[model samples]
Target: MATVKFNPKDILYHYCSTEAFHSIVTTHSIRLSSMSLSNDSMEGKMVEEALARLAECDKCDQGTISLLQAQFEVYLKDVDGFGFCLSKKRELLSQWRAYASDATGVAIGFSRDYLELLREEYLRQRDPFLGFTIAEVMYDPEDHEKQVRPLYQQIKHAIDEGDLLEAKKHSPLRSWSNDTETQRKKSCLASLGFSTLMATLAFAFVLKSEAFKEEDELRLLALINRGEIKKLGFDVKSNSLRPYREYELKKFDQCTPVIKEVILGPKHRSPISVVEDFLRCNGFGYVHVSRSAVPYQ
Candidate 1:
């Protein structure tokens, strides 16, 4: 459903600043930011909100509610999820305004097929611990509502007609209070419930605010263990350290380069040859470059 929805033949544009463009062309990689640390303060809240709506359970004791909320936050911070966002609209003004920084940047175009291959490669290796998915962002309410319904049903089944709030197996937030046989059963069921809820995260990552429907975003997201992240790199912006990992784009095995085209932003006053020369110098001679048709200054 991913490549089908986004169209593998379509070129996904990554709008970035001129400096970022230089870094990309030189390194042949893309940067992904942790979802929890994205510019949107509501980045990781959608799943929680959707679960509340679908469960329709009345509020429980303040202590119980706090525990589940804490668990959810722990899960997000436990396996840091990161996303590399791209737009199907090659020259969308909003993207140029948002990601193209200072109204003077470029949109680097990459092949959808190549990106898909990279995702498949990640899965193909069967690392078992690594998780990844590429998909078109869902902005429609009714459409995504249908997507989350099945998970809600599973949760309902797990609790057996008792609402999620009533299924309060809150023995302890982190571990069992005692090793009694009955307590062990409760702990097992609680683990099952949380793990089921975890399945909703992939959907959560690809769903975005409708106010941004114009961007028609597609995301290549990676969710990995916190232990592995400690050894990787991060980027600092706005005085905060964000976990990030770069995916290589340049192909060295005598295949077409993943980068296919580039569009100079409307206010990108650099000559067309600047991008062209860089591509050629970096062994990407087949890439096509053009100026943006938008009239924005």
Candidate 2:
């Protein structure tokens, strides 16, 4: 049986199209070429000949090839115009340091845009039962708080219209006036109280309101951010939520004593900081952290 070998040019050509690759490398029994692979081997000579062809290709760039070899890693497969594949490729592309000013900016902006889309998709699919669904906390400050005001106004409008769900949708964006770490978290916890309470009292409440307690839920979220629990734990790969919840709750409990002594007292701790300090003191170690808290209004 004859074994076909890969052409380096083929690899380069497929890569340049800015698309997923369709070619597959078959792993069959290795057949030695009529040429031996040794330096003196015909197999080696033939492979070298193929590589020379690729090096001399007029369309190829040594600079681009070197950049790819040094920095880029690809996961190519046969999928065309597929959103998931495109997104995955874009994520891989984001790690590269783009040097051209226009290209660099576009690359950075696209990475952020794709990341937000993924986050929104996850949140939509998870249908989280706890935490702030408010608008202020979610708005990006890179846009200079312009996004938050409109979102907060929408929440206000929703409140006036008696649209609780609509209000929940805008609640996470409420961190605009929150200028300190403590304030932002306290505000988030305070807001969650209404979100949880309304859900419990008005709706059927199949999900336990107790599990949605401000402290507990915040701890779980903190653990997730810290990578103590799988970040995707909320996505529920397992049928039972109890195990993941219990695991996070246990970690949270371990931090409680430190939280009470080291964080809950003076120095005006932010809610997020309190959680972080508590976690850090309880074996996670020191983490440099900062967050915006709302000044006293």
Predicted model with the maximum lDDT: 1
Q: What is the Cα-based TM-score of model 2?
A: 0.15
Q: Model 1, residue 218: displacement in angstroms?
A: 0.6
lDDT of 1 at 23: 87
Candidate with maximal TM-score = 1
The digit string of per-residue lDDT tens for model 1 on 1-297 reads: 333333436688899899989988888777766877787887766655555555555444444445444445545666656788898887788888888895699998988877776776667665634435787888876665566666555554544534333335542465645657656555545555455556566676777778889989998887756667543577878798888877666353435357878999999988888778988998678677899999998
Task: State how far residue 188 of model 2 sits from its true place (Å).
Answer: 11
For all predicted structures, in order, the TM-scores are: 0.81, 0.15
Assess candidate 2 and give its lDDT.
0.23
Candidate 2, residues 229-292: lDDT per residue as tens digits? 3222222223532112211111221121111111111222336465455445545355333321
The per-prediction tally of clashing pairs is: 0, 25
Single out the weakest 10-residue window by summed lDDT for candidate 1.
158-167
Model 2: lowest-lDDT 10 consecutive positions? 12-21
